[model samples]
Target: MAQFYSAKRRVTTRQIITVNVTDLDPFGQGVARHEGKALFVPGLLPGETGEVTLTEEKRQFARGAVKKRLSDSPERVPPRCPHFGVCGGCQQQHASVSLQQQSKSQALSRLMKRDVDEVIAGPEWGYRRRARLSLAFSPRDQTLQMGFRKASSNELVDVHQCPILAPRLEALLAPLRACLSELETIRNPGHVELVLADNGPLLVLRHLAPLSAADRQKLERFSHSEGVALYLAAQSDTLEQVSGEAPWYTSDQLRLSFSPRDFIQVNDAVNQQMVARALTWLSVEPGERVLDLFCGMGNFTLPLAKRAQSVVGVEGVAALVAKGDYNARLNSLKNVTFFHENLEEDVTRQPWAKAGFDKVLLDPARAGAAGVMHHIVKLLPKRVVYVSCNPTTLARDSDALLAAGYQIRRLAMLDMFPHTGHLESMVLFVRE
Candidate 1:
């Protein structure tokens, strides 16, 4: 049994005080200083005096919720989403668009210390290209449920109309609910991860156990009747399709083919823009060689191959590499090569890893490439484009890059997951 209480861990009631939010942390929480201690405040605006009831406090920092507003910021606005605070989907719903963009842009500015004027903005509403809604049953009675979790508790938020999802995807929710109601063995179908490909929206339903024959038929019927794709998740970080014919989606300029189970960018509009900007920043030459790290299915490699003499994409998953090779063959690009390399572990393997490329692009996860940056810099590429979701980790890695005699050239912010405090940024580094 879990401990209900601990003497040292017990939270103490602190005086409610309003403080001006200064910045945002990696987790999308607002950062404010109170009585010389840092407090992670949610639902706050910078330059706004908001009162907070400290919930958990460490020696250096604290976490708290909004208590009262002694003074409100000029940029704070009414949240359009009905599930703003209740749902954990977006942390910056109440924050103004300009304010959020500034917060996001400042992250890049502070980290790279480079001028970032070209901000990529997209449709603020109905722009989410992908999402994962969780499943949970009501504790009081056996009531089937599907939605995201609330910000305050483990309880489901019961998201019905997500304004951030594309209209096509938003319209499919009702039909999906009806389809799920007919499934006999879907009592605990807790998560429905939806992805909008160029082909159509794909739904990956996550159940606690395997499905029966009847349940499989029901999914096929739903997929055909609703004219949408269907998928299933056997476990966390895993995905598979329930039906035989999985759908494919694409962009006008590029044809990106992948499964819902695979990792794809969440925002389609912003992703297209991100890919373009990454290539523009790369500025590959006719004779230049390029290497794309963490290149899932050639999102960057395919584009780079079009410009460079040769392009190499390395990923941890062999399936993606094979799929990437398929993608290259489909596009008839013969110069692009896909390789499976554990970047985090084999950063210093020299030619055994990645040979010297004129340019490189690394799109790493939140954990950052701290483990590999030092060893990987041995290639001494003329230019590098680093895409990061966490600014703190980006800063730590940037410090390493700077130590390797690299100078920050450009930094730009992308409002990929808008209405959320989470900031996404990309940087260009040049060897001096």
Candidate 2:
């Protein structure tokens, strides 16, 4: 006989418990154990005791919010941002910069089972060259809300100033907000993106509806007065420039032009250092060919081209491939070539891959280069440099290289996003 089940759920009473945090997790959460289950509490530092109320509970793990701190760690410091707790932009502002880097390094070392050779970092504040702010019209207040979202919520928090943003971009917040508030057609604005290019500042506005002539004129005047490059986006793919010239940034003395939507490093200073370090670690000789996978707009490819006999850049995006090719021509790099190919698929069968490479470099997204790891091994490059945004995937992919008799030569943590949970790392692997 089959049994029928009801949809009712169990309810448990809320309980406040004392927790002593023993460690800090990679995501900036305090780690403790309650009844043998891992308990994670945000805003609670290591060596601290707090009264925590469980916000989420599961059989294996639980999450909680600190009600009151019983003790504090010596490394704990007051957050610099006014919206630190409310704004989801930063996570480790409460912890000292040294503590933040130390916790992240320890976490990464445990994961990699190898000590980080170096930590490449830049200014802890005002390092972000690009930012995207959400826009919402408040019917109750009759005002425009422009800012980042609340932590783990869909709600928006109005931000007037952000310390992490570059100085020029931060200063434009008030003027940009005022200009947008005066526009009649901006009732339901989509979003706004600000970028500090080497040339100047650029702004991209996304709107759901078309702008009226008067509103467009006002925006144009604002752009002109502020010396900003303004681009209007009716849809995600469409961009119409109303004012200012094309924006570009220089890296390794090479000027690369990119669209507002192009993906570039958020921190410019660290990017230059990272590029130079990658070249040094690879030790590219002028007589050897190099392969750069997931190369976006030739950030590394063009630089590698300067040092290698020939360089081939493979990207999945067609527009980026075009941009990479355009940048190569713009820089008069004759030996570098860009190809649009799906990296997840078998790239070894491609014509460019058949030519082989003396060294290889790849900078994959958070998902990591799992699909292409085996391919790199099969290519049997002399040395391989892997730049990863996700440590878990990097570790998983590193196993493939290890299995193929490749050993880690160097590993360094890139403090790409400071005061935040995000960590970037680079590893050099050489054939045993």
Candidate 3:
């Protein structure tokens, strides 16, 4: 018998296929079924038909780019930013704000298995108070390119003006780019962070190499001319203030002083409203002891202290814990205390956990508080508020509370990031 070799099948990466979008995913991608697999098409809206070219293919699903739309949805609207489709900062700019929120709300509701009781929103544009722009130097052009990363790629898209940024920060982009382009030792710059604090605008430049004296003076001059606080980050952990005072933002009548690298909510107006709403839903009593988990820089802890008998804030980052303490002192909040501990581990053994809390409030990261959900149950707090930035994790963590006989008293969708796919929410769980 002769041995014969057969040619292997070839799979084409790019194939145009007509798709009828039945729904929109949480990330603003259109949902359609193509050849028994879920097809995700960008820039396509629900109730729209489009020709999509498959860009990525996997066993269970596929992602594609919209080649041509056969039909359009009434809810679709024009994106405001010039860099809307290219920039990765926002995903739902093409859709109307109402449509985006509705899609996100439906997705969240399906995951949580409950109807969202309320929706809290703020200004759609000019709401971002903080943003970090990527910096790269093109060797061919001998010019510094400053902008955000392209969607799902490392390539940077040069952004002239960001409509979502605060007015003051947006205005500084051109001049700041000009100033950075003139710097000598900033060829291999890391990134530039622009923050509009309550006091003033702040600029933090991350430089991999040491800056020369002349470059420092130039930066100082630019900072003075723009009246923006400038900080130079020579290392990941250190920041040297080249000009201006420390930055702080006010919330709940308390001043929170934070370093430039600290994690603060990007939206100022929504954050203020979120804090107020969280407080209102928590309903902290004057004589009740409260616990705030994953509390960074006392965003919620200090406010709870004003109403509660005493409030304890537990944070993982030591720097944020220190800032929390500092902010507590700055606000003259004597009833609150800050503790630095890894919340992922068993925090029930900590001194702060020993004293039982009447109520608990947790504002966790996108990962949610899987590690602390069980611990919160053991504490037997009468009421618990969970502030989540990721709905999947929130739903997973909510199981623990529900299993422990806690009922969701209130659930509200927080539109912290208007145009982005980031779905923030808060839920109040009352022990039955």
**Reference-based TM-score of each model:** 0.88, 0.96, 0.95
Give the per-residue lDDT of model 3 (tens digit) for 247-271.
9998898899999889988888888
Residue 263 lDDT in candidate 2: 98
lDDT of the structure predicted as candidate 2: 0.92
Looking at model 2, report the run of 10 residues with the lowest lDDT sum.
Answer: 4-13
How does model 3 score by TM-score?
0.95
lDDT of each: 0.79, 0.92, 0.90
Q: How accurate locally is residue 329 in candidate 1, as Cα lDDT from 0 to 100?
A: 89
Considering TM-score, where higher is better, how would the candidates rank from best to worst?
A: 2, 3, 1
Q: Number of backbone collisions per candidate, in order?
A: 5, 0, 0
Candidate 1 structure quality by residue, lDDT tens digits, 102-156 = 7778666767666676678799999987888776655467555767888757888
The positional error of residue 116 in candidate 2, measured at the CA in angstroms, is: 1.2
lDDT of 1: 0.79
Q: Write the per-residue lDDT of candidate 2 for residues 292-371, one digit (tens) a residue.
A: 99999999999999999999999999999999999999999999999999999989899888889999999999999999
What RMSD value applies to candidate 3?
A: 3.2
Q: Give the candidate number with the greatest TM-score.
A: 2
